[model samples]
Target: MPIDHKQPYDESNIFARILRGELPAKTVFESEHALAFHDISPAAAVHVLVIPKGAYVSWDDFSANASDAEIAGFVRAVGETARIVGAEPGGYRLLANTGKRAGQEVPHLHVHLFGGQPLGPMLAR
Candidate 1:
Protein backbone atom coordinates (compact mmCIF):
# COMPACT_ATOMS: atom_id res chain seq x y z
CA MET A 1 0.00 0.00 0.00
CA PRO A 2 1.11 3.53 -0.68
CA ILE A 3 2.14 5.44 2.43
CA ASP A 4 -0.54 7.62 3.88
CA HIS A 5 1.07 10.98 4.37
CA LYS A 6 -1.62 11.85 6.91
CA GLN A 7 -0.96 8.82 9.10
CA PRO A 8 -0.07 9.93 12.59
CA TYR A 9 2.92 8.50 14.39
CA ASP A 10 2.02 5.56 16.57
CA GLU A 11 3.80 5.76 19.89
CA SER A 12 3.11 2.08 20.54
CA ASN A 13 4.79 0.82 17.40
CA ILE A 14 7.48 -1.79 17.90
CA PHE A 15 10.35 0.53 17.01
CA ALA A 16 8.95 3.23 19.21
CA ARG A 17 8.66 0.75 22.03
CA ILE A 18 12.26 -0.28 21.55
CA LEU A 19 13.34 3.34 21.57
CA ARG A 20 11.44 3.88 24.80
CA GLY A 21 13.07 0.79 26.34
CA GLU A 22 9.69 -0.82 26.67
CA LEU A 23 10.87 -3.59 24.35
CA PRO A 24 14.27 -5.23 24.19
CA ALA A 25 16.46 -4.99 21.12
CA LYS A 26 19.92 -6.33 20.42
CA THR A 27 21.30 -2.87 19.92
CA VAL A 28 24.43 -2.35 17.88
CA PHE A 29 24.67 1.42 17.77
CA GLU A 30 23.06 4.34 19.51
CA SER A 31 23.41 8.10 19.28
CA GLU A 32 21.37 11.14 20.07
CA HIS A 33 19.94 11.09 16.57
CA ALA A 34 19.56 7.41 15.81
CA LEU A 35 19.55 3.79 17.01
CA ALA A 36 20.72 0.64 15.24
CA PHE A 37 19.91 -2.94 16.08
CA HIS A 38 19.74 -6.43 14.64
CA ASP A 39 16.55 -7.42 12.87
CA ILE A 40 14.48 -10.04 14.67
CA SER A 41 13.72 -11.69 11.35
CA PRO A 42 16.88 -11.16 9.32
CA ALA A 43 16.85 -11.38 5.55
CA ALA A 44 20.62 -11.64 5.28
CA ALA A 45 23.57 -12.97 7.21
CA VAL A 46 24.01 -9.43 8.44
CA HIS A 47 20.82 -7.43 8.76
CA VAL A 48 20.62 -4.33 10.86
CA LEU A 49 18.04 -1.63 11.25
CA VAL A 50 18.79 2.05 11.78
CA ILE A 51 16.02 4.22 13.06
CA PRO A 52 15.63 7.84 13.97
CA LYS A 53 15.05 8.62 17.65
CA GLY A 54 12.17 10.82 16.71
CA ALA A 55 8.64 9.84 15.76
CA TYR A 56 8.63 9.40 12.01
CA VAL A 57 6.04 7.24 10.34
CA SER A 58 7.93 6.71 7.08
CA TRP A 59 10.93 7.84 5.01
CA ASP A 60 8.87 10.70 3.62
CA ASP A 61 7.89 11.74 7.13
CA PHE A 62 11.49 11.58 8.25
CA SER A 63 12.75 13.62 5.29
CA ALA A 64 10.03 16.18 5.74
CA ASN A 65 9.96 16.54 9.52
CA ALA A 66 13.38 15.63 10.92
CA SER A 67 16.23 18.12 11.15
CA ASP A 68 19.15 18.07 8.75
CA ALA A 69 21.43 16.91 11.52
CA GLU A 70 19.04 14.11 12.41
CA ILE A 71 18.76 12.97 8.80
CA ALA A 72 22.51 13.00 8.26
CA GLY A 73 23.27 11.40 11.58
CA PHE A 74 20.75 8.64 11.04
CA VAL A 75 22.21 7.81 7.64
CA ARG A 76 25.68 7.82 9.12
CA ALA A 77 24.54 5.46 11.86
CA VAL A 78 23.28 3.06 9.21
CA GLY A 79 26.74 3.00 7.64
CA GLU A 80 28.39 2.61 11.01
CA THR A 81 26.17 -0.31 11.88
CA ALA A 82 26.85 -1.97 8.56
CA ARG A 83 30.60 -1.64 9.02
CA ILE A 84 30.44 -2.94 12.57
CA VAL A 85 28.49 -5.94 11.39
CA GLY A 86 31.12 -6.67 8.71
CA ALA A 87 28.83 -5.83 5.83
CA GLU A 88 30.66 -2.82 4.41
CA PRO A 89 33.64 -4.27 2.49
CA GLY A 90 31.54 -7.12 1.18
CA GLY A 91 28.89 -4.57 0.18
CA TYR A 92 25.36 -4.19 1.47
CA ARG A 93 21.92 -3.05 0.50
CA LEU A 94 20.07 -0.27 2.26
CA LEU A 95 16.33 -0.26 2.09
CA ALA A 96 13.29 1.38 3.61
CA ASN A 97 9.80 0.20 2.90
CA THR A 98 7.43 3.15 3.18
CA GLY A 99 4.15 1.28 3.49
CA LYS A 100 2.56 -2.10 3.91
CA ARG A 101 2.53 -2.96 0.23
CA ALA A 102 6.20 -2.13 0.17
CA GLY A 103 6.70 -4.54 3.13
CA GLN A 104 7.07 -2.09 6.00
CA GLU A 105 5.86 -4.00 9.04
CA VAL A 106 6.25 -1.10 11.40
CA PRO A 107 5.18 2.52 11.26
CA HIS A 108 8.48 4.02 12.40
CA LEU A 109 11.03 5.21 9.87
CA HIS A 110 13.88 2.74 9.62
CA VAL A 111 16.67 1.79 7.22
CA HIS A 112 17.71 -1.80 6.69
CA LEU A 113 21.38 -2.63 6.05
CA PHE A 114 21.80 -6.13 4.69
CA GLY A 115 24.87 -8.01 3.48
CA GLY A 116 27.39 -10.73 4.50
CA GLN A 117 26.73 -12.60 1.26
CA PRO A 118 25.68 -12.19 -2.33
CA LEU A 119 22.23 -10.65 -2.00
CA GLY A 120 21.25 -11.30 -5.59
CA PRO A 121 18.87 -9.07 -7.56
CA MET A 122 16.30 -6.65 -6.16
CA LEU A 123 13.44 -8.88 -7.22
CA ALA A 124 12.82 -12.44 -8.30
CA ARG A 125 12.42 -13.08 -12.00
Candidate 2:
Protein backbone atom coordinates (compact mmCIF):
# COMPACT_ATOMS: atom_id res chain seq x y z
CA MET A 1 0.00 0.00 0.00
CA PRO A 2 1.13 3.52 -0.77
CA ILE A 3 1.85 5.84 2.13
CA ASP A 4 0.80 9.45 2.45
CA HIS A 5 3.51 11.86 1.35
CA LYS A 6 2.44 14.42 3.93
CA GLN A 7 3.14 12.08 6.77
CA PRO A 8 6.19 12.64 8.96
CA TYR A 9 9.40 11.27 7.54
CA ASP A 10 9.82 7.82 8.96
CA GLU A 11 13.41 7.35 10.08
CA SER A 12 12.89 3.61 9.80
CA ASN A 13 11.95 3.69 6.16
CA ILE A 14 13.90 1.30 3.97
CA PHE A 15 15.76 4.04 2.16
CA ALA A 16 16.64 5.69 5.44
CA ARG A 17 18.02 2.43 6.73
CA ILE A 18 20.06 2.04 3.56
CA LEU A 19 21.41 5.52 4.00
CA ARG A 20 22.29 4.91 7.65
CA GLY A 21 24.29 1.84 6.64
CA GLU A 22 21.86 -0.35 8.56
CA LEU A 23 20.78 -2.06 5.38
CA PRO A 24 22.66 -3.15 2.29
CA ALA A 25 22.18 -1.63 -1.14
CA LYS A 26 23.87 -2.23 -4.46
CA THR A 27 25.29 1.27 -4.53
CA VAL A 28 25.93 2.74 -7.94
CA PHE A 29 26.79 6.32 -7.10
CA GLU A 30 27.06 8.51 -4.04
CA SER A 31 27.58 12.21 -3.48
CA GLU A 32 27.28 14.78 -0.72
CA HIS A 33 23.56 15.18 -1.25
CA ALA A 34 22.43 11.97 -2.90
CA LEU A 35 22.92 8.25 -3.32
CA ALA A 36 22.05 6.01 -6.26
CA PHE A 37 21.65 2.28 -6.15
CA HIS A 38 20.17 -0.60 -8.09
CA ASP A 39 16.57 -1.40 -7.22
CA ILE A 40 16.02 -4.81 -5.72
CA SER A 41 12.83 -5.24 -7.71
CA PRO A 42 13.73 -3.75 -11.04
CA ALA A 43 10.95 -2.68 -13.38
CA ALA A 44 13.30 -2.62 -16.39
CA ALA A 45 16.69 -3.83 -17.49
CA VAL A 46 18.28 -0.83 -15.82
CA HIS A 47 16.24 0.24 -12.84
CA VAL A 48 18.24 2.33 -10.43
CA LEU A 49 16.83 4.52 -7.66
CA VAL A 50 18.36 7.88 -6.90
CA ILE A 51 17.53 9.41 -3.54
CA PRO A 52 18.63 12.50 -1.66
CA LYS A 53 20.86 12.25 1.39
CA GLY A 54 18.41 14.14 3.53
CA ALA A 55 15.22 12.84 5.02
CA TYR A 56 12.29 13.76 2.82
CA VAL A 57 8.84 12.28 2.56
CA SER A 58 8.58 12.99 -1.17
CA TRP A 59 9.56 15.32 -4.00
CA ASP A 60 7.15 17.95 -2.76
CA ASP A 61 8.86 18.00 0.61
CA PHE A 62 12.34 17.87 -0.84
CA SER A 63 11.82 20.72 -3.29
CA ALA A 64 10.12 22.91 -0.70
CA ASN A 65 12.82 22.49 1.93
CA ALA A 66 16.10 21.45 0.33
CA SER A 67 18.65 24.16 -0.37
CA ASP A 68 19.68 25.07 -3.91
CA ALA A 69 23.03 23.35 -3.53
CA GLU A 70 21.39 20.22 -2.13
CA ILE A 71 18.92 20.17 -4.98
CA ALA A 72 21.67 20.63 -7.55
CA GLY A 73 23.75 17.91 -6.02
CA PHE A 74 20.80 15.52 -6.05
CA VAL A 75 20.02 16.28 -9.67
CA ARG A 76 23.65 15.96 -10.66
CA ALA A 77 23.84 12.68 -8.77
CA VAL A 78 20.92 11.38 -10.78
CA GLY A 79 22.61 12.22 -14.06
CA GLU A 80 25.92 10.77 -12.91
CA THR A 81 24.14 7.61 -11.82
CA ALA A 82 22.47 7.29 -15.20
CA ARG A 83 25.77 7.67 -16.98
CA ILE A 84 27.41 5.07 -14.76
CA VAL A 85 24.55 2.66 -15.34
CA GLY A 86 24.66 3.20 -19.12
CA ALA A 87 21.21 4.80 -19.31
CA GLU A 88 22.16 8.22 -20.60
CA PRO A 89 23.44 8.95 -24.17
CA GLY A 90 21.12 6.46 -25.86
CA GLY A 91 17.88 6.96 -23.87
CA TYR A 92 16.26 6.55 -20.47
CA ARG A 93 13.22 7.43 -18.36
CA LEU A 94 12.97 9.14 -14.98
CA LEU A 95 9.95 8.61 -12.74
CA ALA A 96 9.10 9.97 -9.30
CA ASN A 97 5.98 8.77 -7.53
CA THR A 98 5.09 11.56 -5.14
CA GLY A 99 1.81 10.65 -3.49
CA LYS A 100 -0.43 7.77 -2.67
CA ARG A 101 -2.28 8.21 -5.93
CA ALA A 102 1.05 7.91 -7.70
CA GLY A 103 1.84 4.60 -5.95
CA GLN A 104 4.60 5.83 -3.71
CA GLU A 105 5.23 2.68 -1.71
CA VAL A 106 8.15 4.21 0.12
CA PRO A 107 7.81 7.48 2.00
CA HIS A 108 11.35 8.63 1.24
CA LEU A 109 11.80 10.68 -1.92
CA HIS A 110 13.38 8.83 -4.84
CA VAL A 111 13.66 8.94 -8.61
CA HIS A 112 13.54 5.81 -10.69
CA LEU A 113 15.80 5.66 -13.73
CA PHE A 114 14.76 3.06 -16.26
CA GLY A 115 16.43 2.11 -19.52
CA GLY A 116 18.41 -0.61 -21.35
CA GLN A 117 15.29 -1.59 -23.32
CA PRO A 118 12.52 0.05 -25.27
CA LEU A 119 9.91 1.07 -22.71
CA GLY A 120 6.72 0.85 -24.73
CA PRO A 121 4.26 3.51 -23.56
CA MET A 122 4.41 6.01 -20.76
CA LEU A 123 1.16 4.59 -19.43
CA ALA A 124 -0.60 1.31 -20.09
CA ARG A 125 -4.04 2.82 -20.43
Candidate 3:
Protein backbone atom coordinates (compact mmCIF):
# COMPACT_ATOMS: atom_id res chain seq x y z
CA MET A 1 0.00 0.00 0.00
CA PRO A 2 1.19 3.49 -0.77
CA ILE A 3 1.95 5.65 2.21
CA ASP A 4 -0.62 8.35 2.57
CA HIS A 5 1.39 11.51 2.37
CA LYS A 6 -1.87 13.33 2.95
CA GLN A 7 -2.70 14.10 6.54
CA PRO A 8 -4.84 11.39 8.01
CA TYR A 9 -8.28 12.52 9.21
CA ASP A 10 -7.36 16.18 9.52
CA GLU A 11 -8.57 19.39 7.92
CA SER A 12 -6.87 21.24 5.08
CA ASN A 13 -3.42 22.53 5.93
CA ILE A 14 -3.02 26.30 6.20
CA PHE A 15 0.75 26.46 5.60
CA ALA A 16 0.34 25.15 2.05
CA ARG A 17 -1.84 28.04 0.92
CA ILE A 18 0.21 30.52 2.91
CA LEU A 19 3.24 29.27 0.96
CA ARG A 20 1.30 29.53 -2.29
CA GLY A 21 -0.02 32.97 -1.30
CA GLU A 22 -3.54 31.84 -1.94
CA LEU A 23 -4.51 33.25 1.43
CA PRO A 24 -3.67 36.65 2.77
CA ALA A 25 -1.42 36.79 5.83
CA LYS A 26 0.53 39.34 7.84
CA THR A 27 4.01 37.88 7.50
CA VAL A 28 6.49 39.04 10.11
CA PHE A 29 9.47 36.87 9.22
CA GLU A 30 10.46 34.17 6.78
CA SER A 31 13.34 31.90 5.84
CA GLU A 32 14.08 28.95 3.59
CA HIS A 33 12.87 26.61 6.30
CA ALA A 34 9.78 28.38 7.62
CA LEU A 35 7.40 31.31 7.37
CA ALA A 36 5.86 33.26 10.22
CA PHE A 37 2.50 34.97 10.06
CA HIS A 38 -0.07 36.46 12.39
CA ASP A 39 -2.81 34.00 13.17
CA ILE A 40 -6.10 34.78 11.43
CA SER A 41 -7.96 33.47 14.45
CA PRO A 42 -5.71 34.81 17.12
CA ALA A 43 -6.03 33.55 20.63
CA ALA A 44 -3.77 36.14 22.21
CA ALA A 45 -2.64 39.70 21.66
CA VAL A 46 0.37 38.46 19.72
CA HIS A 47 -0.59 35.24 18.02
CA VAL A 48 1.55 34.03 15.15
CA LEU A 49 1.98 30.77 13.36
CA VAL A 50 5.47 29.58 12.49
CA ILE A 51 5.13 26.99 9.80
CA PRO A 52 7.67 25.03 7.82
CA LYS A 53 7.72 25.67 4.10
CA GLY A 54 7.46 21.97 3.40
CA ALA A 55 4.16 20.32 4.15
CA TYR A 56 4.28 17.67 6.86
CA VAL A 57 1.46 15.51 8.13
CA SER A 58 2.14 16.54 11.69
CA TRP A 59 4.87 17.47 14.15
CA ASP A 60 5.94 13.85 14.62
CA ASP A 61 6.24 13.32 10.88
CA PHE A 62 8.11 16.57 10.50
CA SER A 63 10.60 15.69 13.24
CA ALA A 64 11.13 12.25 11.73
CA ASN A 65 11.83 13.45 8.19
CA ALA A 66 13.22 16.98 8.64
CA SER A 67 16.99 17.40 8.33
CA ASP A 68 19.22 18.96 10.95
CA ALA A 69 19.59 22.18 8.96
CA GLU A 70 15.88 22.40 8.31
CA ILE A 71 15.12 21.96 11.99
CA ALA A 72 17.78 24.43 13.04
CA GLY A 73 16.62 26.99 10.52
CA PHE A 74 13.05 26.62 11.75
CA VAL A 75 14.10 27.13 15.36
CA ARG A 76 16.07 30.22 14.45
CA ALA A 77 13.16 31.62 12.49
CA VAL A 78 10.87 31.15 15.47
CA GLY A 79 13.13 33.19 17.72
CA GLU A 80 13.41 35.91 15.11
CA THR A 81 9.68 36.01 14.54
CA ALA A 82 9.07 36.12 18.26
CA ARG A 83 11.17 39.23 18.58
CA ILE A 84 9.44 40.81 15.60
CA VAL A 85 6.06 40.14 17.22
CA GLY A 86 7.35 41.59 20.52
CA ALA A 87 6.90 38.29 22.32
CA GLU A 88 10.50 37.83 23.44
CA PRO A 89 10.82 40.25 26.35
CA GLY A 90 7.23 39.80 27.52
CA GLY A 91 7.59 36.04 27.09
CA TYR A 92 5.69 33.77 24.71
CA ARG A 93 4.36 30.29 24.24
CA LEU A 94 5.20 27.93 21.44
CA LEU A 95 2.49 25.39 20.82
CA ALA A 96 2.40 22.44 18.45
CA ASN A 97 -0.59 20.15 18.40
CA THR A 98 -0.01 16.79 16.73
CA GLY A 99 -3.26 14.91 16.35
CA LYS A 100 -6.98 15.18 16.98
CA ARG A 101 -6.38 14.08 20.52
CA ALA A 102 -4.21 17.13 20.95
CA GLY A 103 -6.67 19.54 19.31
CA GLN A 104 -4.76 19.76 16.08
CA GLU A 105 -7.31 21.08 13.63
CA VAL A 106 -4.73 21.70 10.97
CA PRO A 107 -2.61 18.73 9.93
CA HIS A 108 0.37 20.75 8.79
CA LEU A 109 3.15 20.95 11.35
CA HIS A 110 3.39 24.43 12.88
CA VAL A 111 4.41 26.28 16.04
CA HIS A 112 2.04 28.85 17.49
CA LEU A 113 3.93 31.78 19.01
CA PHE A 114 1.72 33.88 21.23
CA GLY A 115 2.28 36.43 23.98
CA GLY A 116 2.24 40.19 24.64
CA GLN A 117 -0.03 39.47 27.56
CA PRO A 118 -0.39 36.96 30.35
CA LEU A 119 -1.41 33.59 28.96
CA GLY A 120 -3.81 31.93 31.32
CA PRO A 121 -2.39 28.48 30.80
CA MET A 122 -1.06 26.23 28.10
CA LEU A 123 -3.53 24.02 26.30
CA ALA A 124 -6.41 23.02 28.51
CA ARG A 125 -7.03 19.30 28.39
Best by lDDT: 2
- lDDT string for model 3 (38-93, tens) is 89889999999998887676778888888998889989999999988888998989
Model 3, runs deviating above 4 Å: 1-12
Pairs in clash, predicted candidate 3: none
Give the C-alpha lDDT of model 2. 0.96
Top candidate when judged by TM-score against the true structure? 2
Residue-pair clash count for candidate 3? 0
Residue-by-residue lDDT tens digits, candidate 1, 1-125: 35454489989888999999999999999999999999999988998899999999999889998999999999888888887898889899999988766877788898989999999999766
| Ranking of all candidate structures by their lDDT, best first | 2, 1, 3
Q: What is the TM-score of each candidate against the true structure?
A: 0.93, 0.98, 0.87
Residue 46 local lDDT, model 2: 98
What C-alpha lDDT do the candidate models reach, one value each?
A: 0.89, 0.96, 0.81
Q: Looking at candidate 2, what is the lDDT of residue 7?
A: 95
* Poorly placed runs, candidate 2 (over 4 Å): none
